[model samples]
Every structure is written in structure tokens, then in C-alpha cells.
Target chain A: GDSVTQKEGLVTLTEGLPVMLNCTYQTIYSNAFLFWYVHYLNESPRLLLKSSTDNKRTEHQGFHATLHKSSSSFHLQKSSAQLSDSALYYCALSDRYGSSGNKLIFGIGTLLSVKP
Target chain B: EAAVTQSPRNKVTVTGGNVTLSCRQTNSHNYMYWYRQDTGHGLRLIHYSYGAGNLQIGDVPDGYKATRTTQEDFFLLLELASPSQTSLYFCASSSNSQNTLYFGAGTRLSVL
Candidate 1:
């Protein structure tokens, strides 16, 4: 079985502050694909960043994450946070080659609130 | 852009009632999925289909049954709903199992 964990259920920060949302995963397979999906209020959840290669930082919309196979983690980080960045972030794992085909396992999600 | 549309943005039904959530993807993707969002639980996969007439059980499929009648259409059925079934449901489609998923606006279901 595969699973994702997001330890921080809520992370509030001031505008312009650094943003770091923790994410870790566990799977029996050696090769893993991790993803970050952002969900805004009243909007459909969309992909923000996806792991390209292990240890290679993948970034989009000022957010970046690196998949560390050694630690089984793909933590999302931003140098500065904006009020618009406030949303629910989910870390997920793609079990493409698993017995059940390509299924995505998501964490509990972290609500990132940025205040001015 | 990929588009996934779900009907009945809000639904309310009593326990033991029958409910069906519909989804259609114009992207013509081979894979479609049904997920439920709950507080402290994030999004949990209920069921998915890769193509017409195909159905695969997901992490939380105990109270759900899914049908893929066409390549663009997928449906989630709750024959006998329960209170615990109340949640926000999202439908998504991807070109393949490994690609990025495009989600629908979501349906909020309340089982009283």
C-alpha cells in the first residue's frame, strides 16, 4: 500500500514570509512520482508542481519542490508568500505501476493562510 | 484546456435514499475518477474507470458503485446512502494514469 502525509493541517503566515509545507510518503516501489495540487475556494484543484527526477527541484508559480528518494519526501516551498497563495495544498503520490493501475493517494492537506 | 464537468453542484438526500453523481470529460481521456473530500481526510478515491464498461475499486469503495458508460461519461451511484457519506465529491480526468488530472467544480452531498 502507498500513502502520503502532510503533518501540518493549518499553516498561517504573514505576507512576504517564506512558505514551507511538509510532505512525505511511503511506498514499496523504488521509483515514485510525487505531486502538489492546489485547491482554492470555489475552484477546482489543479496541479502546481510535479516531480521530474529524484532530487531535481521542480517548480511552478513561484513554488518549488524536490523529490528526495533518500528521505521519501517532496516538501513544497516558496521564497515569499502572497495573500492569493492562501489555499489548501495536497501532496500526492502516483501509483502508476501498482497492481491497481495509476491511482493517486493524497494526504490530509494543509491549509495555508497568508495574511496581510 | 481539459474540461471535466459534474452535475448537481449541491445535493441533499435522506439516509437509505438513492443518489447518483454524474461526470463528463470533454478531454476524451481514458481515465476518469471519483473522489470525496472531507475535513481532516483530504481527497479519498472512491472509484475510477479507464474506459467504457470498466470499473475499478478505489480506497473507499465500500458504499459506492461506479459506471463508465462511455469514454466521456462516468457516474457514481449510492444505492443506499448513509450519514457518513456526506462530503464534497470531485470528478477528474487524465490523459492517462500518469499524467496531470483535470478536476470538475465538485458536488457537495449531504446525507441526512
Candidate 2:
């Protein structure tokens, strides 16, 4: 079975501070896709960044994540965080070869709180 | 842009009550899914369908039923709603089974 883990339950930081949210996964497939979905207070969850090739960094909206296949980790990072960047972030994995390859396995989301 | 709409932004029901949540996607996607979001649990798939008249069991399918009447419509049914079923439900659609998913605004269900 595939599973995702987000170790940080809450991350509070001041505006302009760097942001890093941890994400890891356990899957049997060698070629798996990792995704970062952002959810605002009242908005629908949307895709932020998706992994294409392993060990390559994917960036969107000032946020970037690098999928490290050797470590099975895809951590999201931002050099500077803004108040508007505060939201719930979910890390998900899709095993392209599994029976339920299309379905994503999500982690316990991390609540990012940015303060001025 | 792909649009996924879920009716009944909020719902309230009692134990042993019946409730149905509706979802519609105008993107003509072949795959639609129902997911529930809970504290400390992220989002768990309740049920999903690859096409009309097709059903696939998800990780948490107990105490719930789902129907896919058309490619654009999918419904989640709870015959005996309980307090444990109280959560934020989101419906999503993807062009393919394995692709970027577009989510709905979500429906908050409170079962007493």
C-alpha cells in the first residue's frame, strides 16, 4: 500500500522568512508522481507543484519542491513567505504502476501560518 | 478552466438520517472522486468512478454509497449518517484517472 507523511502539523513564521514543509512517501513503484496541493480558508484545493522527473525541482507561485527519489522525499520550500501564503498544504503520491495508480495518497496536511 | 461544483455548501442531519451530496463537473472528465477531509487525516477517498455507471471502492467506503449517473454527475449517499461522518467533503474531477485534479468548493456536513 502507498502512504504519505507530513511530519509538521503546524508551521508558523513571520513574513519574509523562509518556508520549508517536509513530505515523504512509501510506495513500491519506482516511478511515482508527487504533488503539492494548496487549500485556502474558503477556496477549493488546487495543485501547486507536481513532480515530473526525479531529483528535479518544480516551482510555481514562488514555491518550489524537489523530488528526491533516493530519499523518497519531496519537501516544499520558499525563500520568503507572505501572509497570503498561509494555507493548508497536502503532500500526495500516485504510484503509476499500482492497482490504484490513479488515486492519490495524501498525508496529514501541514497548516502554514504566516504573520506580519 | 475546469469547473467542479458541489451542491449544498453545508448540510445538517441527525443519526439514522439519509443524506445525499451532489457533484457536477463541466469539464467532461472521465474520472470523478468523492473525498472527505478530517482533522489530522488530510483527505481520504470515499468513492470514485472512471466513467458513467462505473463504481470503484475507495479507502473509506464503509457507511456510504455512491452513484455515477453521468460523466458530469456523481453522488455520495449516507443512509445512516452519524456524528463520525461529520466532515468537509470535496468532489474532484480529472481528465484521466492519473492527472491533475480540479476540486470543488467543498460541502461541510454536520451529523448530530
Per-residue CA lDDT of candidate 2, range A3-104, in tens? 999999999999999999999999988888999999999999999999948888899999999999999999999999999999999999987632332688
Model 1 residue runs over 4 Å out of place are A97-100
- lDDT by residue for model 1 over A1-116, one digit each (tens)? 79999999999999999999999999987767899999999999999989838889898999999999999999999999999999999999985542335678999999999999
For candidate 1, what is the recovered fraction of reference interface contacts?
0.56
Model 1 chain A weakest lDDT span, ten residues long: A94-103
Candidate that would win on TM-score: 2
lDDT, candidate 2, B7-64, per-residue tens: 9999999999999999999998888999999989999999999899999999999999
Tens digit per residue, CA lDDT, model 1, B22-63? 999999788899999998999999999989999999899998
- TM-score, model 2 to reference: 0.97
Candidate 2 at residue B21, lDDT?
Answer: 100
DockQ values for all predictions? 0.57, 0.60
Q: What is model 2's interface RMSD?
A: 3.0
Candidate 2, residue A99: how far the Cα is off, in Å: 11
Off by over 4 Å in 2: A97-101
